[model samples]
Target: MTEFQTIHPLGDVPPQSVESGDTSGITLNVRHEISMVQIFARNGREMELAKKLNIEGVPGRASETRSFTAFPLAPGQWMLVSKNAPGSGFGTGIAKKLKGIGYVSEQSDSRVCIRVSGSQARELLARGCRLDLHQSVASKGFCAQTPMAQVGVLLHQVNDGPTYDLYVYSGFARSFWEWLAHTAGQFGYSRGGRGH
Candidate 1:
């Protein structure tokens, strides 16, 4: 028998801090203990799927809770996220729950979640994101699929602090991080812990 160990997407990168002076305006964290699943409702079954999940019908919004968060990716697609211990099979559980109403694809290993937050968070993202992030247009519960630094990402605004969770493909995590670190330098940033 062979044994293997799970490695975090950004485990090899050292923690970083770029300060403009005595103050740091942004914080970056790699969320490693989360499980993500992409869900696509069967044609004409969007309402049934939402009802099964006990969430409002799929709209261009995000639904969050202490245990999980579901956000729309398109008209009939959504990404479900939840904190899970290693090997918890969170995606499998969701697949079972959704059963025939939706298709659930595990994205836990395919995507990386980077939490960007602080007073300057929105400012930093505006450098590369084209979305109009004005508070009135992109407050909490807002989510969209967009490109940042040429990398396709699912961006979710989680709070009024203007914090955002950028879910990028794991293969591009390092490149995205480098871009983020460089862009955030002017604002001064401190690296945070890997998980909750």
Candidate 2:
């Protein structure tokens, strides 16, 4: 049997090789195999659903379980993200677990998740995103639904390095990538590997 390797949306593109007279301070990579699910609470089941899912604190923030992270997009809407490791069936299992309590639709292929990390990550994003990404304000686990280069995106700050996960529609993946690659060129970035 021939084993197949998954490729990211921008997998065909070579790592940028031009030395723009500056050191590349960031790593821009596609997270090709993350499992994502759109979760909507059944009427009047918001808090119950949150509690059942072990969602901590408030909305517009992220909560983590053992292997899954939930990003609240609205009062009753959320996007659940999980690393698609072997045996990780986030969407399917969550749907089964929430049976009559909420709706879970697999979005693992509907969008592309791009991760940007390093010293200039925030500066690179500032060119296209309008959010106040300062660590003191956005902090860790803060997420927002906003537009980047005119493309609607879900931007999540995962940590202090201000590493971000940009979730963009698959239809705009190439366009988004082009814009990002061009803008990040200023700060310099290296292409990275297939996702976790």
Candidate 3:
């Protein structure tokens, strides 16, 4: 967890409310790796977590009733989330009770994350992605894996009502976010969607 801090997305774009400049909100606090820790359950338990989530998990789960957290999808499988230290508690705890589980590692520190909102979010994302961000395709709480700016990106379409969570690698973060802000300019974007 990180305390939110004000930041600037681009050199020319003034601060906007729709975008949060906090590095913690966008970039993982990870001391090692590239982004953050992302866990996907492969065994029955993890599948359960995916279904309960009501949204898509990276590796995905078998059914909505099946649930697992912080577990691995399979051998050598990886998940992303904020990882500076160790976070096996979320997965290990569940694995202890699971019958057949696999390896789980956090790659959050290995990547970067950003929250893209504001009225222009859909248009901004269109600059890099082909996913239909409309409500029909981008239902709240939905998660999708796609490329943004030619880099791997995990798009978390949270049902935060109207907010969206965009995550990428620290390396790609600076450029990727800048593109988002540039596109958002048309819909009138501000930090966190508030206003300058």
Candidate 4:
């Protein structure tokens, strides 16, 4: 591997050349592999770690995109997530600074998170979602636990760019893609509509 290997080859995650799809031209695409890392710490430790890391927000989050929705899930319980997968030392950086004890896990396989946002964001969701995502309830940083087309799902309502994030098990991407494709057709009937 060079300094950086252009992946998109054969793997559980994504390889190198994932393409932009266009059942209707909205162009659905994603990284071959979803990168995940989990931080396991006791209750009080999260707050302390957040303070030390200046926990203003989750890292690698991209909500703003002219007109879109990008919300975060409260950085929830695991403490935090970085743009890049951080290992033991990354956790230790905070652990040492904050004087706390905890464990860091690189969880690239356990869960698969897909970012979904675009002109026809809502339309694609209508394909297989049961949740009512109106303006008031589906605001930025807000999330809902629901299933898509029978699969368990965690939907994060974002503001600006990424309208939503679909969290599902690694085993269900193909079916989910099929579901999205069906609904996305209606969404792309007129082209990506500018809304979240």
Candidate 5:
């Protein structure tokens, strides 16, 4: 029997270290093999679903717990993300927990997440993303669905380090990465290891 291996969306690209002078103003890290699940509450069962997930009702915005990060997609709909080992059945586990209260669909293979950080992170994103990323408007825990480099993405502000997690469809990962690399060139960027 031939054993198959999983390939990351970015293929075999090595971690980049495009920088000038002594320091880099931006950093990029690809988060590989993350588990993503989309949940939609059953009619009249929104609160029940939240209870099962131990969240404070359905999130109106992005919310994070020790195990999962939930992002609102629409009314009573959300995308939950977690860092679980590859093929760990993370989505299946979430589905079993919610059971009949919400519908769950595995999205792990369909999307990719890239963590963009450092002092120039916002500036680099601003070059293509139209969303208002001003600190006063997009503080920690904020999230939005927007287009960057002409690709639709779910953007999440994870910390005051001003780090952002940009979730893009797996098929467009390389394209988006190229755009990010090119745009970040002006700011001098460093790439971190995959799954970091």
Candidate 6:
């Protein structure tokens, strides 16, 4: 059997930034390929299933895990994210482990992630997102699904630096990337081709 290798949508590109007289910000990196899974309750048994699985359970709306992130997508549904963990096949492994507790589907290649951070991160995001990204409201671990630049995305505020991880459909990856790059251009931004 031939082993299919995973790939980062953007690889080793380097950061792009513009600095003019002390005002500078915006940094973007294509997060490294990691295992991602979407798990949904099989029969309105979300809470039960989550509890049985044991990894931070399913997150509440607008919340995420500090160690291994799990973001709620809707009632009875959540997406599990493992950053920098080995290769793919996690979803299948999880399904086998759960064994009929919940329905698990692989999302490793179905979506692409972009990490943006810095002082200007929130400011840049405000231009295209309607979510209230205020530190007090969107503190670390806050997560939401919203339309950014007219594209549906899973947004997570990951830290005090107000860094954010934006996950979008792989099909729309390039479009989303262009929008992010162009929006951040005004404040001078940097880009990383590979590894979050």
Q: Which ten contiguous residues of candidate 3 have the minimum total lDDT?
A: 23-32
Residue-by-residue lDDT tens digits, candidate 5, 1-196: 9999777777555544424312677877778768899999999998788777876543336877888889988777889998886479888888889887889988888888888888888898899999889988888988888889989999999987788999999999989998998788888664444532
User: How well does candidate 1 match the true structure in TM-score terms?
Assistant: 0.87
**Candidate 5 at 46: error in angstroms?**
1.8
The C-alpha lDDT values of all candidates are 0.81, 0.80, 0.48, 0.51, 0.81, 0.74
Across 1-196, the per-residue lDDT of candidate 1 in tens digits comes to: 8799777667765543424212677878777778888899999999888877766544658887556799877877888899885369888888898888889888888998888887888999999999999998889888888899999989999898878999999999989988997888888664444431
RMSD of each: 3.8, 4.7, 8.7, 8.2, 3.6, 4.2
Q: Which 10 successive residues of model 2 have the least lDDT summed? A: 13-22
Report the error of model 1 at residue 152, Å: 0.4
| Backbone N/Cα/C clashes per model | 0, 0, 43, 20, 0, 11
lDDT of 4 by residue, 1-43 (tens): 5596543221332321212433333445443433454454456
- After the best TM-score superposition of candidate 5, give how far the Cα of residue 69 lies from its true spot, in angstroms: 0.8
| Per-residue accuracy of model 3 over 39-107 as CA lDDT, tens digit each | 545555555544434434344222122232122233333343433333545445333533254334445
Q: What's the CA error at residue 185 for candidate 3, in Å?
A: 2.6
lDDT of 5 at 41: 94
